[model samples]
Target: MIPKLPGLGPLAALLLAAALSAWLGIAGPISIEGLYRWQNLLAAFAALAAAAIAYTAAMAKVKLDRQISDEQLMRRSLAILLKVEFAIQVLRQEARELEEKLGDWKNKSFKTVDLAISEPKEILEAWETLDLFPGDLILALRTLRASLVLYRTDLAKFDSQVEWESTTLASIKANPTSRASVAAKLLIQQSTDTITALRATITRLTNLLNRA
Candidate 1:
């Protein structure tokens, strides 16, 4: 079992050493007045006890300092983890909402769809406002920014597909020739394929943002 300190500081060790030295001086069988024996013996015992007390005090101080350092480090680490968790949760919620809007737009008319992908900017602003550890917040912010970029790229692709599909539909309606109809149908098929690919990419990115 470990020896527990009754209290802090070197007072206990000093008292213990003083008591032991006094006991030894009184009980030991060494002679006195023979070549400056009694005083010398007491002095030697007191010196030894002082040394022991000093060593104990130094060791206790070291242990206390280490304990304080460890506690400070643990607290800092926990605070960083909490911040990261909060940022991740916010990003995930935003990604979920974007994913739902994208899914809804897949089957709806492009004129009826209003894609507003602005929450990532809000998340980044909120993250910047937080009092975070030096580099940790930057790492999270970079990841969120990258996700937003990918989301924007997908959104742009979807927009282009809508434009291409609309142009193709207008051409088919204006000129009903068999050749024009076949060309418009082909363009429509290609636009549909592009939209499907963009939707899949959006879903994958959203999943990644959610899991982050």
Candidate 2:
């Protein structure tokens, strides 16, 4: 019957046998030819085992690198999404503040809308470069970007009109009954209306970005 070797798997048992044969041949007065034969066999098995372990380690490293790369891409994509969302939120607050100023035109001059609204620069750049986000996220960002462009264009037009009308508004406090003063009041009312419309659109865009 084969001898029982507790806790020794097949590979472990083969290595043990090879090591025992080498020890006995070298140190127990075996023949020189016998020792040489055992040494050759042991060297061959050791080389094969080393090569197998190396191949397995190389494959595992490759798989780990791929997984890490995927994780990094995902994290970058999420960061871009959050940044864009934050920018849109800032724009919304600026719009709301301007909306409140419209109620007190007596103290406030008919100045241009603050066109410093944050744009989706980073997210759009990522879309152009990596296209890292999923399809739905890409679609949402595209729509948001277009909306911001249109809003900016509308603001430019309003600012141009305000510049042209500002001259008549200068004397409105001194001579409220004059034609220029009446026209200035009319222009202020128009500006208020424009601000309301812009705020509505900005609110809609904020809601859309929030959903993302």
Candidate 3:
């Protein structure tokens, strides 16, 4: 592979300079005449080579640092993407559960029942507290909110129908009339269907939120 340097840049330069100076002194003639001729020329050439080597070593270190920085950035980016993927998966699962619950509710009858008896406020609060309930989960939350409102409205309507049925049933009991009883039964059936549909809508919204 690549040759490794013990030190880089300024350190490498100082080392090379010291080594070259030592080599020249050991090899060159000590006489003043020889120092002014070939001895001086040889020392000059050795110094130039050492300087070139030092410059090359310093550039290699710079390149290595840049490579390390790039790798670190890539790793950080991958970690963030993984976290986002996990969040999406969690949202999807919760939405699916909500949908399933809605489907079950659709088959139920609640003509004389008060939806408030279920006290879904606590459930709503729990849903709101989920990690993905706001911001990115806004669309999912809105769907669930609409379903909750519909359920509340249907519950109110069911209560009114129950009151009307109670009055009609009393009248029928006093007069023993079949017509009033039949009319009351029809109203009850319609109210039951409305309540069931409302519950189904809510369940569907919950499922969507879970899946989101």
Candidate 4:
């Protein structure tokens, strides 16, 4: 069994051992060659002790570094998750505005629908950073990305319908016989249907992301 020197370091233990050996040597008629051999053994023991201390210190340092690295990675992931949450809130605000805009189709603005805002930048930015998330979470981000594409498509179609409506709206309003008004209403209804579907998709996806 190895001896445990309480409150004594490697150097202190080695010194005590040397002192004990010297006292023993004095008790007997010590030869010079025997004393030299004992001194050499003590030197070899000290070198081994130094190497053990160094190895133990190195292992401790490695453990500390790995722990710190893991903590930093976890912290970074949490920050990205927070950004995603904030981006979702921004989308919900934009959704409220979209609801108001699509509320009435006929009294809607004569100008073309701007598709620029259909792809919300905030959500996209957050979505890009979700690569670090789990596979299921990454899939949710892809679904949201697809939804945005559909939203943009709806906006583009809405813009085209508005352009077609504007040219014939005034003329059709004057003539009761023209079928242009009917066509315009059909176009509006189609876009409205798509927009309605998109609203539900966004809500479901938002809830899904929140749970994730």
Best by lDDT: 4
Cα-based lDDT at residue 72, candidate 4: 65
lDDT of 4: 0.52
Clashing pairs in 4: none
Better of 2 and 4 by TM-score: 4
Candidate 1: lDDT of 107?
36
Error of 4 at 178 (Å): 23
Give the Å error, residue 41, model 4. 3.4
Error of 4 at 114 (Å): 4.7
- How many Å off is the CA of 3 in candidate 4? 19
- Judged by lDDT against the true structure, how good is candidate 2? 0.51
Residue-wise C-alpha lDDT for candidate 2, range 1-212, written one tens digit per residue: 99964422345447757777777876886777776877876687667666666766788799999877866665565565556555545545554444444334463344443322345466457557436554545555555556556545445544332422323344433322222334333333433443343344445444644563
lDDT of 4 by residue, 102-132 (tens): 3446543444443123444655675666655
Better of 1 and 4 by lDDT: 4
lDDT of 3 by residue, 47-121 (tens): 766777777778889999887775554444333333433443343344344333323535332234322222234
Worst 10 residues of 2 by lDDT: 175-184
lDDT tens digits by residue: candidate 1, 1-212: 99975543355456656765776687764345543645665576567667766777899899999877766654544444444444444545544553444345353333212332333344445455444333444444554555555444444443333322222234433322222234323333333333343344335444544453
Error of 2 at 171 (Å): 28
